[model samples]
Target: MSEYRSLEDKLNYQFNDEQLLGLALTHRSFSNVNNERLEFLGDSILNYVISLAIFQRFDSASEGELSRMRSSLVRKETLAEIGRELDIGELIKFGIGERKSGGINRSSILADAVESIFGGILVDGGFLNASSVITRVFNKRLEKLSSDDFMKDPKSLLQEKLQDMGEPPPDYIIISTKGKSPHEVFEVACISRVLKKEARAEGASKRKAEQKAARIALTEMDRDR
Candidate 1:
């Protein structure tokens, strides 16, 4: 009960249906009836709620800008950060195998739990109630958000900068991969032949690693110039 109290306190919401909360906390590896479906539903709702909020808040922002901001806000890394704040990892229920494999700290699992919890809230109350919870969770982030966040992601920005400088597109190589699905560490190197620059970075996913590497390469190139 005390364990649940902490989660409820962080979310600032109580569940009328305790089963929904249980289901949300249950990972696929834990049970046959799990949170995957709820994750799917919650994913859609979260995207819509965030999109609407960004749309209303940034009246002067272009469509592309709004889209970019929404992407940043709804990304797995951002959601995982929010989940950690709520202590979702401590509350998650995993199978013995998953527990042994360190699923508790996996970013993908944490993010999925956040969304699954929202899906449960949506079912227990309604869209308005779920939206209210989302608003509470994302309030600080939205407040601190800047227009600069609306710019393209690191990878896209790097590509554009290189193209404008008449440099060839950067080539990404996977330096190494470690761990299993949903919790893997991917190290990637970004090399720009024309710029004679190379940078390496590691992330929880390959795409994220590539993005980080691109950011590093771009920073190095800027420094050289």
Candidate 2:
């Protein structure tokens, strides 16, 4: 009971099927019957929920603006941030191999678990129940939405900045990755072929790592300018 209480308080959603909640917190690295299906279902539901909410909330916004806003909210980093607030990482059940390799702290696992929990809610209750949970979870973010919330993703922004300087596109190289599948950390190097600049960063996914490295490169370029 104590084990579940903290998460319940954080999410503000009590589980009718505690088993489903358990499944949600179980990573694929732990078991064959794992959170993957739930993650898939939850991903779709989250997109729909966020899209509809943003669409109705921003009546004057164009399609492009809406899409950008949605991307910002649903990105892996954002989801992992929210999952951290819930302390979901500590609760994730990983296999011995995954545990020894530091899979529990992996942002990708935490983010996917968050989505799986949403899917569990949908299964235990219904769409409206899950929608209520999503609304509650996202209330503050939705309230603070604005034109300022939208921006090109880090990778895109970095690429554009280099191109504007008459430089060749940055070359991204994966330095290494750690932990198990679906829960690995990607270390990437962002190298500017023309400027001979290099920056390295790590993230839960390859794309995220690349973006982080690119962001670092961009910051250095800006500071130099």
lDDT of each: 0.86, 0.82
| Overall local distance difference test of candidate 2 | 0.82
Q: Global lDDT for candidate 1? A: 0.86
Compared with the true structure, what per-residue lDDT tens digits does model 1 show for residues 1-225?
655878887889988988898899999999999999889889989989998999999888766567667766888889999999998897889999998999999999999999999999999989999999999999999998887765568789788877877877889999899999888999999988755657899999889999888777665664453
- The candidate maximizing lDDT is 1
Per-residue lDDT tens digits for candidate 2, residues 1-225, read 567789988778888878898999999888999998888888889988998999999887755557667766877778888899898887888999998998877888878998999899899889998888888898899889896544467678777767766877889999998999888999999988644467999999998899788767766654443
TM-score of each: 0.69, 0.68
Clash tally, candidates in order:
0, 0
